[model samples]
Target: MIMKYAILSQTKDLMPTLGLGTWQAPPDVIENVVYNALELGYRHIDTAFNYNNEQAIGNAIKKWLNDGKGTRKDIFITTKLPHVGNRASDVKKFLELQLKMLQLDYVDLYLIHVSFGFHCDPEKFTPLVKPTGEYELDMETDHIATWKKMEECQKEGLIHNLGLSNFNEIQIAKIIKEATIKPQVLQVELHAYFQQLKLRKFCEENDIIVTAYAPLGSPGAKDHFVNKYNYSPDTFPDLLGHPEVKAIADHHGKTTAQILLHFLVKQKITVIPKSTSENRLKENMDIYDFELTPEEMNSMKKLDKGEKGRIFNFLFWKGVENHPEYPFKLSDDKD
Candidate 1:
């Protein structure tokens, strides 16, 4: 029997629970990754304007659509609004560029990539940095206004639904309370180690679909962050080496990554595991074949460290943590 899986958003859209993430996917390799993922039954493809691989993704999608593999409607495409384009007026402009790059007239979901805004050079779309070597932020950032613009895009058929990423529960609540069109989804870092139980429960009660970006604990996230942004490697934990996760994997005869993903899917959360390796890509989608016992679920739940387990705190952005809307505050339970 074919196992079916999906997460229904507030708009009643059926998003495939498993998706291929395109973050940090090199341009030279992304096209093939996209093609292979589509051929291997990945109907959900996640990309972002900042990923700089939309053109490559567009190429792959064009080829697949031309080959009659699937129609545009069969694929659920999600992209984000970059920090520079986080303003109310720049919303349509940035999405139009992404739509053009992705070779699509409309996207299935468009998200506000970050809560804070950046001062960018519109000509090159590069963010301006202050003399202190920090990103130049727009102190007048207004997410409510930005979200209203997103609603306009939806009404104009530029996008099917709206959502937010890297936003906190309070931020989401603010948007919901002030929004004419409620956010349909919320994308954030999620794994067994940092299950985000409180936020997940909030979204569940609010009818918002939650998507996990680093579902496998982002095994190499530490190295990547340290090398790229001068962050301390100690900020990230090794999820694959966790004793509880290893035991669970051994019991199920699966890799630790698969067990991590399976645990989240069991909670009805959508996940996007990014990998350029063909084997890993296939393995990421191979979780539906088995079910974790209730005891195994409880064991996974024990791994949660609440706010302390968060990896992408965005604190490396210098004064970004000081922003009023900064999401990853509180080094403990209050967050």
Candidate 2:
């Protein structure tokens, strides 16, 4: 089984191009999903503190290791710092908690999940909400300070690779300018519809490996927003069901999901598409066997709708658009 990889500039670590994304995955079933993914040859697993499923994922990894399936060094585990813990003071605290929950001495990659901050209760570690039902915004959110603390943790050998998620180029530049160590990866919402060409180019020049979250256009996200916040977008992207994508899939004798993933993987853009179904998991990994033609890749590139194609604006968090560190532009202006 051949697999593509992105080399981290700092340590030259080979991060597998395809990984298992675990956002919106319920904790109850996450253990089995993770265990099944490991059995199916997945080496990279992406999770976050806010996902609240790290403990279960830890159980799966622990069980797999105990069964003598693989050692910790063989697997790459990536988790993040939650928005509530976005402050420099909270970096080590939350990281230690995540390590404790994941039952690991260190994580392969630790990312600052978001650029913004949310005020939360210290004891519960839950984001505090205003009486108006909006998130309590932390106006003084400081990226450079938080990033400095992240570098300290990396120096202490707690995090092997340090990265950012949902951070724009400007925010990343600020960190790079202040840091002793540069960020090795940038995980963002990337798909065929919302291809971040300019951002990817910037990362390439900076030697930051870009990881794509919601790589399948996050088909389940609409329902999640509606159920959790009673908010729904005017339109939801269905990249897997698009006629153009289907045609490409049929041409290659592959599923639409496979074509979507292969299109990104072929470009050396890491993709973490989430799935619980065993068949889909295997299907997603089988993409390495086939290659999309140059013409097909061009056609796929035409699907880039830019900012309008973006699905995760984080608007469901009520007043999040007003945050000082909000990465996306809320109006007609391009980010």
Candidate 3:
């Protein structure tokens, strides 16, 4: 069963609290993954232009529709405006291309993938970086200008709702102060380790629904990315292996991953945990069947290490720290 959250929106839009994330999912396997997710009763599927698998997802959705499993209105599809397409002038063109890739005329929600703008080769949308290894930023591009274009997209029916990802408090506040429509959601790297309590509180106060990506701490994700790049920082502490988490799981007769997901759901935060295994997918969807106690929730809450536990530090975007809107400026440590 899909659990829906009533978010502050232009209309009464009940969004599914659980969604299937498409980041890092291989294009070869993504179509099958999406098809299975739909068959398993997932009503929310999250993707982005940067993910580079929208066409396969679109094909799966097309087949699912043809088979009469569900209608377009039944699913909440979300896509992002990539950092490469971050300029105000490119928003419409960027979204139009994404729509064609997804084979959809309109998306349920559209988001700015990141706050920093990337100056990319216009045709390939490839980031143009300097020889010194810093990202070439569009210093002239501003969030206010980009947001105005996003508002235009909403007014033109290209997107039903608009939101942001990886944006900091000051950035969000600036948008709120100048926006014609408030951001309906904020997607960020949230987990048991880096709980983002302060940011979550801010979003809650402002009526923006928080979607926690990497909600499982994306166990081993650190090691994979770091080893692949030969970078420093140790692997993240395993949330599923934490003694308290495991003990709580045993007490509740649930898996460790289930405990992690349940903890976030109880906090009224939306989650999109990615998995290739069918059993794991079913396990994630079954979170609604059980509940965590107040004590259990508190125990899990203590796992928060504040800014020390963030995993997706965007270190790959060289010199990202120099950006004015860099969200993770609190730490120089990369996970």
Candidate 4:
């Protein structure tokens, strides 16, 4: 029973305007969170292989289905392919791994985690840091070839919908021109501080759906995933508490999370915010019945500072250069 979902593209259906991000939550808590989210009417869950918790989500889904609370078809599950797992044979192989871990045959959507392929094999899988870093060692399987395999997976029914994450406009343009199946969804680092208006508009013009992360901006938590590498929010007014956002939150008597979420929902973009706390889980799922007014939405839009954009700084990942999806200020792009 999907209580709420944002129809991103013309095809994909009923993805809750708000879902949970599974970046660094503990596996044990993630299990409980999944069950709690379902109980609280959250019909969507977003996890990735890189998050190292897909199996936990999968197990929880299995239990929910086995207990008759909901069937496997009831939940909207989305995961992604790791850069190291982009080779054709490796993709098929990793897809099997994800399937077995989730205890499900197919996912609602499958995303390519990064727009580039690894520079080496699994045994020698390495990450690149800077210009001096290594590029693809396996020259045969670049990003396009990997995407071709992903397209094959879609055809074989391993994945129902396809998306790309951490990709910039140029990278997406290349894929859009070459791809037989255009991306139905695009996940990017978006927040009140960095609204990515142009990127969002480009995606919308191309009929692609946008998914945002860090709506309230990074909370300055130091973990392996969202480390302290982000530009501090301390200098900037907290988006969740800004007078504008507060006024909007007070308008409907909802929390800042709900307001932040509704802002994106109004734009018809999907959001997946992660929380292990049961109360927060319930609070996050209660946004289906309300809508943000045009005035309020426009007010929030003014909060866009457009400085220090992008939170997913995969400077540690290898083979990120010259492939065209490197998500930084290009020479020609406005700096």
Best by TM-score: 2
For residues 4-41, write the lDDT of model 1, one tens digit per residue: 45555556777888899988898799999999999999
lDDT by residue for model 3 over 44-123, one digit each (tens)?
89999998999999999988999999999999999999988887999999999999989998998899999987798877
> Which tens-of-lDDT digit does each residue in 1-335 have in candidate 2?
33588889999998999999999898888899999999989999999999999999999999999999999998999999999999999999999999999999999999999999999888888889999989999999999889889989999999999999999999999988888889999999999999999999999999999999999999888898878867655578889998999999999899999999999998889999999889999999988988888899999999998888888888888899899899987665443
State the C-alpha lDDT per candidate.
0.87, 0.92, 0.87, 0.74
Any idea what lDDT model 4 has?
0.74
TM-score of each: 0.96, 0.97, 0.95, 0.85
Better of 2 and 4 by TM-score: 2
Weakest ten-residue segment in model 4 by summed lDDT: 220-229
Q: Using lDDT, give the best candidate's number.
A: 2
Model 1 misplacement above 4 A:
1-4, 7-9
Rank by TM-score, highest first: 2, 1, 3, 4
- Cα error, candidate 4, residue 141 (Å): 6.1
Could you list the CA RMSD of all candidates, in the order they appear?
1.7, 1.4, 2.2, 3.7
Pairwise lDDT winner, candidates 2 and 3: 2
